[model samples]
Target chain A: MERVPILKIGDILLVSIQVDMSDQTAVQLQEDLAERIVATGCHGVIIDITALDIVDSFVGRMLSTIASISKVLDAETVVVGMRPAVAITLVELGLSLNGIRTALNVERGMELIAAHTDEREFAFDDEPDTETTASS
Target chain B: MERVPILKIGDILLVSIQVDMSDQTAVQLQEDLAERIVATGCHGVIIDITALDIVDSFVGRMLSTIASISKVLDAETVVVGMRPAVAITLVELGLSLNGIRTALNVERGMELIAAHTDEREFAFDDEPDTETTASS
Candidate 1:
């Protein structure tokens, strides 16, 4: 597994990792990541791991732990870019990530956040527009 | 599409979503996620979307964004539970998440992190054991 690389865009953080789906390196990366999340005050996070062959129980648990820690620090996390074979194996293995947020790719993950921000703006605009109409 | 659910285990938070590949909900979800990431200081993230039938460019883009944000927050993120069909479609569409961390399932993601923590402990133990042997 390669070392995880982190980049930032605006308030969002991007983490790129090359993980061997069947190795211990993946676990180490998670711990390192958790520490970073705490250190950085940025709220958004994106994880890109397109290179993986399999997934096991240990990896899943670590991810959950990371998410929990992030919440304590007031940051949000998202996972993106996964291979299909690995996905199937995970389900067949009965590995349930019941509460994790996931997207097909990183692009989609970003979109999710963008939309939310846009919606808030729209809602705010709507209130002002309605007020103008009422005043007129 | 059903709303994505945020799961909490101990101090860990998992964000899980079920996507409909044919619809635009996935994209919307991505945008929404970005906002949440910014608002919540949770770096550890898990995305489980195994129900998608197809993955397109928009979805791919969102995933990329999610990964990017994670990096900014210095958090760890993992994509889990993708279907084979969706995976093929993403690749066929030339959608690539060149730098992201991904897993087959939630469990495996946890394992990856656990293994790393374990390795660190082992290394520390080894140092002490080595000293003991030298003295003997």
Candidate 2:
């Protein structure tokens, strides 16, 4: 089983999926990410997939699953650097990746996470009922 | 030369692309949407593309152009109802439709626009530099 490394930068977790993903590798990543999020108590997660040329359904679901798991641990997930071809292919595979946030590159993703972390904390504290979410 | 209707939902502009888009139509939309955005003083735009089965580069660029136009006027655009197949085909066609916000359905998309409009106004007042953008 291949392991995906989860690096912590400041209070954020950075994950760049650089290899061709297998079902086993993806599953291992899901488990590993959950453990990492719990241990690190990170505020956000940014997964860069710039190196991946092809993304099948399994890999797409893995991305969605990772985002879901990260949310459970009180972290926001932003998948970045998705090639145009890969995105088109993923949608064709019947995975629109709804409910997941994405950015063009790592830099943009970092900005996104940084901009939200504070607002999220404020929303959670000040107005739980009128919490504003940027989900589409 | 068919005209796409831009209906006003309060201060939000709702546009549903219900016909197959030709180059001219797409171009016309870019112009018409901008004018409407400025005229109505709307804070957000929701574009429903569920009726579009195939999105070529021209249409893809049109969507991107519309998003850009909205932003210039201080308005946010959320595209919704991207079918599974259309998403796959567009990416294969080499059009990623980056920098545009997307939603699973029209209802969810409207919610996105409404939520952001309120938050955006406050952010502009509080911290102009930290505008929370949800782009892919």
Per-prediction TM-score? 0.40, 0.48
Q: Write one digit per residue (lDDT tens) for candidate 1, span B25-125.
A: 65555555566666665555666555445557766666667666765664456777677887887788788865456778666766654554455457567
Interface RMSD of structure candidate 1 (Å): 14.2
Model 2 lDDT per residue over B1-136, tens place: 6666565555667676755677888888888889989898998888877556777887888888899989889888888878899988977877888778998865677678878876777878888777755321
* Ten contiguous residues with the weakest lDDT in model 2 chain A: A127-136
**Pairs clashing in candidate 2?**
none
User: What value does the lDDT take at residue B37 in candidate 1?
Assistant: 60
Top candidate by TM-score: 2
Error of 1 at A102 (Å): 0.5
| Model 1 chain A weakest lDDT span, ten residues long | A127-136
TM per candidate, chain B: 0.64, 0.88
Query: Model 2, B8: alpha-carbon shift in Å?
Result: 42
Q: Candidate 2: give the TM-score of chain A.
A: 0.89
Which candidate tops DockQ? Answer: 1
By summed lDDT, which 10 consecutive residues of candidate 2 chain B come out lowest?
Answer: B127-136
